[model samples]
Target chain A: MSEIVDWVAVDWGTSNLRAWGIGPNGAVTFKKTSPKGMGKLAREEFPAALDELLDNVAPARSGPLDVLICGMAGARQGWLEAPYLEAPTDLRGLLDGAVRPTMPDPRIAPAILPGVCQKAGADNVMRGEETQLLGLAALTPGFSGVVCMPGTHSKWAQLSGTRIEQFSTAMTGEMFEVLRTHSVLRHSLTGDLDGPGRAEGFAAGAAAGLDHPEQLLGTLFQVRAGSLLSGRQPDWCAGYLSGLLVGTEIGSNRHLIGDQPVPLIGSPALSALYAQVLAMAGARGEPMDATAIVLAGLKAARSFAA
Target chain B: MSEIVDWVAVDWGTSNLRAWGIGPNGAVTFKKTSPKGMGKLAREEFPAALDELLDNVAPARSGPLDVLICGMAGARQGWLEAPYLEAPTDLRGLLDGAVRPTMPDPRIAPAILPGVCQKAGADNVMRGEETQLLGLAALTPGFSGVVCMPGTHSKWAQLSGTRIEQFSTAMTGEMFEVLRTHSVLRHSLTGDLDGPGRAEGFAAGAAAGLDHPEQLLGTLFQVRAGSLLSGRQPDWCAGYLSGLLVGTEIGSNRHLIGDQPVPLIGSPALSALYAQVLAMAGARGEPMDATAIVLAGLKAARSFAA
Candidate 1:
């Protein structure tokens, strides 16, 4: 029932995996997603997980069809460990160190793209986002600017032409999730997130985070205290905390970001939040379609066929 | 047997409760502890929990014996909500609005001291630490300076004579714990914390936190990356992270602390660590015995009894 496909492009992350079928004519058609990601599967279980997803929509070809994978699936503890490609190198070098995993089925060929790492200054690493960055580089020729990818571990990169000069990561998303779910602040952040006083609270928090980041740790308890002593609503508290964290991420890297617009490669909802914070700090955000960029990155890797 | 026992002082915190038996002569003779605290018991279960603890070391009395209490037991969610007393007031006023809970046992007389709140500039609140600050005042007459108490929710308070002018709370301990146990940093923070490279790692992290607080969120990823790419020891990561958080806490409040030697109150180990960080910041920390001060504060509260 599927159209003719030459290869499958997969973005396998810690929590989930998304796949796209690519035709030889550079057209992307078939699509599938599974919650089973690298985090869920062990070394031995990966083959079956991959096979299950591939068999669902893979076109029947006389020869073994190629499968290109990016993200945490290439992590050290994932399907197969792909060594990190050091930073300052153009992402085109990503395919040179890609790992080819031996599959049980003779009809499947898979290659895992290596993640990028920065050892000097501040040690940092990134996997799937590198592919997205590559896609950004591919989409806009000679693009030179700062890019922000918001996620569990929000990443910021400085790209000069095709080479990534340096990068840093903020524990913004992960910190927010953990603090909301596990900390005392959890008590004050319970209600419909989109309901009541949210905009005011987010604005107040974002301003504080962006202006006086030195007071970041000191002001966190105010989220709970405001709710308790001042009767600040739960929605307001949640929004405020989210804005505070996101704003802090942007503020901390404002020097690298400059006044120039930043390309935000992330989910629509999260990217919009970062865009809001950036605008507040005199900078702007240019929203790039995440799916389109990542697919482009995968297709770029496909061209280096053996 | 406790000699001439007259009343008992208890510090019932979130996770544990500690009791000190005081004689009519004002001598603290018996000390007992239990893991059951305000966090574990429901509203109805508080009485039984308190009864179980008091039933053990509480002295025999012909009439109802007074049980002086402070800390989370007086929290809105604790045994009984002792409403917070707004700041800029002497902590000796802690006893004025202390709640007297009607106990199940006729022989038990309980009074829970109210916590302090700063509602104007920054919404802030503290439960048991108010009593600790009261004790500090009682120990040093006319003591007017800053006090740093390290714990799950680290607190810093400014004292003018006996009055607590203002205070702030940091989620340092809680943040470190959650990140270590729940975040990706958990993978690299294993092995003995006292094993090796502890001091060097801590120093480096402390410097980073003290000199550049805005880089806090950006540099956290380095803890994990260091271990992965740079062969950082687990002890180093643990020590580094610990220093980073503690240093950030002190660095953020450096202006409030000024050139004055801050009083360090809490566990000896934790207080000593804070002292070390303070020393690095060109200030000094004076270690105050927590038990001695709490006993004095509770004894001070006991004087208000009818």
Candidate 2:
């Protein structure tokens, strides 16, 4: 087992396949990724892809290797279906089990665990982000704040003493796409602009939305008419639209999280964007290094198993 | 004045200018248009653009000209600033008056009137489309129904007797543009579809939204997660997304005009699209002839003035 030993942690997602190899000391020695995302691969193809990566990291005689996996790859559509855990769960209870790709050698991957969610009258489920959250909790002891992970559908997970209390997902980014590119507002703004801090228009939009969300559809028309009739700049209107979405999300979830500061996990650009908007709403937030958090989660799992 | 009359109506809008010369009996003698749409011209350039078009059709040397102008050119940003009229107004009362460039001969151009919207304490306003509604009313008497003019912003207006009783605008089309081009959702969708009719994924999206709006954001993450995990088809997801926006519009406005047949005033493609949706919701509808409606509004104004 020692001869075949190497770092093995999987970032298995629906469309992305990523795995890393680390030394015994928890240092990443090498990493590999492939197109064999969970969504594309057939059920039978799972073990082969894992082997393709493991084959590079451990090429010696056959021996057992410690492995860990996370993400949607542990989902129903993944190689080994992992059932969801309810919210307020510890690390082990949050997951079902990891999958071992059926290999000819019968030496397959370890089981992955799924994330948990809890909402009355709603079907709540999460997969990979939970590990990141666990990693986050490991890195920052006694962090009872909001962990916001931004994406196509951004999730705001509330944690209370290492247990995920509750969470909500907002479609602001997706709605932004719908409004900017596919909708009529495209004619008003030609391209995108980036400012270091939150855009003024975004702030205005959020404030307007917080004031009256019911008038959202009607107010958007004024963006075009305002430009056509009053020479309102299109770029500003774009920013305003962004504010509306971010503001709306905050308005919906603000009460749920209380006045706790938010810890953002994601890429730099996304975290910065969220921080800017949160600041405008008078909410406090800090950027947490996602890679560090993911590794911390892995180390915690290793320690748990040990 | 009667003998020289060729086209009696001129519709000047942003980006393009159109004029119709009529015979003595009001039959169309000639029709012409210029690239001088409101989009291309600055505020000061309006008079010159108007003069160029007049030089061709109603030259002073030819005869006395009776022309009516409408569209964005009459907006606050255009050459002649036409104040909007309040709702429940007749064509004559909505008239903002016409303008003739002082440079050319003393020619007369009738200004088109804007429609009005008064929402409680909100200010009232109107524009060129109201004229088209008026024209439509003249052509079809006792016209008491809703007119849906689809464009950047889709406007729905109720015409009672000869007055435009009430109106509302939806940013549905604009939202479509934003989502398709600007947001991360843009990445999830295939650039363009082969044809106009609903795609397969569209139905799924519609059902999803109509059945579960709360799950929208969470489900959208599947687009990215699915691609990451399972290599989900982007094209089908794109269609599904289109359905969500279209479905949301239908769902939100169901209360205002529930299952009622309304007249569609727009392009054939727009008409067909709306018809498909309305059909799904068990609502009846017919396409309003756009050219006829606009001209009818012009004729109605003439008759009302005479």
Candidate 3:
């Protein structure tokens, strides 16, 4: 496995690190993942963590393996700060800002991709998602529109062809999780964010959220009040809360989204949920395979690192 | 002191239990508090917790002390559900729906006041704040205006004279605390919420929030992005976050607020903060003492129990 491997395309995030071994023929030879994310590791430990994860994958590489990394691994607190490539730039511009971190293991050659930043109007930044957007542009040449990447900090990016003009981030996902687990609503909500979450509950909540996004403060309380006064179930309460946050996010940004079919690049369950919420607003959320897009992104970065 | 205490006015909440011993003259004779709030105590433990707090205040008593309890003690998961008194009702009517818990100690005559609920258009509920609103009504005779109570869960009520026609709860305070401590913004913010949290930061953030509260999901992320791009200080980030949330809460409900002075019933610091944010949106927030108000509410509640 080590002898055949040419390079590794890595997506290193705050809490997880995933990698794909690329063969000399430009096809994936192996796939691997590790819990050694950037969040828990110190600057000095990144090289070792990468080496350990790689050692498990291929221990006998004839030459140093080139590693092209994206995401939080390039954060200020990551292995080494990869300065942001200001937005309204082409995905191809990412390679110019790509930084190479000194590695302790001679068998590993590391290059961490720079994140995208929008410094002017609404102070905003993105780390790993920029690469995914780059991948989207690479897979679909001249792709232009809004791309929604949902996660702890869901991002909404505007791209003109292969160039990103502007982007914004919504803390909706994090808010939903915190309120569900830490606020008074926690008492009314039970169950995890796994599976479909709660379709009926989400639809009802999404309706409320979409109707009056400005009335979010009051509507949030409705989640708790619904359970207390109306005997709403735990799952329904959870779904309602989820829908409310998502609806608020989409509703707030819909003006910029227009009526175009937005590309949702994330997990199947989450993308499907976003797609459903999009239809409620008369738009379509086109799902893109996250792995395929990210891999394509890493592959694109390979050209710069190689 | 127990001999002089004719009754006890108690405000029991999720994390704290506070009692005011009332003398025969209808004045607070002594004050005492305990960590045995409804959130930590069980149904059977409420009686003992009340006894311990009362014992610390006044050990020797001649007869059974009439105890009037309000807040979470009457919640569904409380010592006993006092059942929410559906809204469009007067403060005096709260006494009519009060329920007495079966206490083992005959020395303590406990009556838990019911909360208020709005089941129509926007489902909303309030515990403890109802009594404070009652206090406001009692303190300001012929009061007919909106009251903003800031705390863990801030409540905004439309009061016509002594009756609460409608009310809504905003998870602003809880949301602020959670995002500051648990979310990505936590990494950017440092320092306790004590003292006047950065004034300059608040003024700026409040303006942004007031301008476009619909962008709350995005404005929240700026707390981190500001620190990252603009090198914002920790205290500034904290105040900015605080201001953004407070502004959003007030801004979202501004249409109903008009340009009138809202009577703010809560802690001095919190009330001042809300007052500042309200002023930003051209509305005045008149600060009222929380203790005097709640005690007044409980004192008024005493008449019904007696």
Candidate 4:
């Protein structure tokens, strides 16, 4: 028959909404995803969206159901503002900063976890990734080193045991998107990073970004110029743009890695790309499955709840 | 009686069309601009757009009007492909590479000037800016040193007398536009460069970019983090972004400038911004009027044509 839902774990980002139903044994019993992300929903619409997702799998309980969420859903403009928790924070206590939203359904108790913010030297923040970090800590007990989460906003964190000592964010994915779609470089890019010359282009771009990061502004224009002058194919241009941004991100944050192999947490494809670039930069990357980490993180966070 | 038009100088770019009526005495008799740019018009629509703009001001000439055009109008997909004049070439002969398009109205003899292209090292291209370089050469009479043209794609050219030895293009302005509009950093930006804390923010960003050009990808996220953590104002974030991009561009291209006073060419406001950054970098920026340079460049180009 149906497995009883112990709690629900949600990763609500700007462009997507994902929910996982956990069994009492801490195993994920059900998982669902929707395009109705935090970006798409208004404050009031959030409850209905969550309800729709949970309707089929939520266990019929007499009291309130525990729904734990991370990501943009906790941002200032999301369902309810969960002010950021400053960095140098212990991952074990991430759920302590979780704020509960006033819900119309008394049966649903939604607790949104606050993102981690870096206030010193370089200002930075991460919402959903903190959960993943917690999961990482659980998966590898007493883990200490740098963690790279590659995506639209790639985050690099320095962990001291179970505590995140510092972190930085790079708008690498967003920059690639905007340059690919909105800028003049659009004419030169084919949008297929796997096409011919892509690997070579990516390698070249990454090297350039790593060696001379200051030349990024100048380097970006080469995509269009290479097309016009050297007949550089569109796919290669796309690959080069990706490589350049990724390389720059890795190159700039090398200090955080400190000669240690970086733990890359993301989708396989994205993590592989980062791994490739990381290798080129004279470093190694340890890839980890993002979903597993998030589930583990959610389970850990749920254990601390009231 | 309407003033007779000897020839017309047109700067047709991706976003706007500007034309100046030049009399036989080489003086601008009339000037007008339109939203009908090269990007907006199809190949067949170009003649009509030109005719509409030329109407009521063609001087009722019996023969075809001589139209000297520069910019994207000479692009491969423009009215007709004008091809490109490979650089390390003299600016005086820019008209020699001009191509005449087939027109419905024989009354319109449009000779589109070719842009400059660099095939070596990092591939680079410039369309309308070649005219400005030509104009700069004409206005200064054997002007040398590096010339900086700030725009959507900022161009930096090393000119020895009338010949452009080498040049580079930076996607600074385009980067700023995309980051400001499409990225998450948008929330932190006010779209105002003159707001409180703007000057300090700009100076700080420029210094950071100059100091650690490699840190650009990491540096950009500070806008959002600063806003979330320190309540950084939107305007200050905008200024910081602008400064960071500009400083990165300047720092990377320092080799092109070589301790020479750089000539800044563009609208006063934009040139002034570049000037401020240049001053910060210990380089003097000599601002020149873009209109005068374009007119001069066009006149020089016309002098070479039959």
Name the weakest run of 10 consecutive residues (lDDT summed) in model 2 chain A. Answer: A92-101
> Fraction of native Cα contacts kept in each candidate?
0.75, 0.35, 0.78, 0.92
lDDT of 4 at A291: 87
Badly placed stretches (over 4 Å) of model 4 are A32-35, A53-64, A105-107, A190-194, A302-306, B23-25, B52-65, B104-108, B190-197, B304-306
Each prediction's whole-model lDDT (CA): 0.86, 0.65, 0.85, 0.85
Worst 10 residues of 1 chain B by lDDT: B53-62
lDDT at position B122, candidate 4: 66
List model 2 lDDT by residue over B72-123, tens digit each: 7766667666666667565565444444334344565445555455444222
CAPRI class assigned to model 2: incorrect
Distance from true position, residue B137, model 2, in Å? 3.1
Writing each residue's lDDT as its tens digit, candidate 1 over A1-306 gives 545688899999999999988876777778889999889999999889888887656554678888899999988889999989898887878888899999999778989999999987578999998888888888887889899999889999998766888898999999888889888898998777678788888888888899878777877888999999999998899888988888888888888877678999999999998889999999999888999999988877666444
The order of the candidates by lDDT, greatest first, is 1, 4, 3, 2
Q: Compute the lDDT of residue B25 as modeled in candidate 2.
A: 75
Q: State iRMS for model 1.
A: 1.0
Candidate 3 clashing pairs? none
Better of 2 and 3 by TM-score: 3
Please give the distance, in angstroms, between residue A45's alpha carbon in candidate 2 and its true position after superposition: 26
TM-score, predicted candidate 2 vs. hidden true structure: 0.64
DockQ computed for model 1 against the true two-chain complex using alpha carbons: 0.73
Candidate 2, chain B, TM-score (2 decimals): 0.82
Q: Rank the candidates by TM-score, best first.
A: 1, 3, 4, 2
The DockQ score of candidate 3 comes to: 0.73
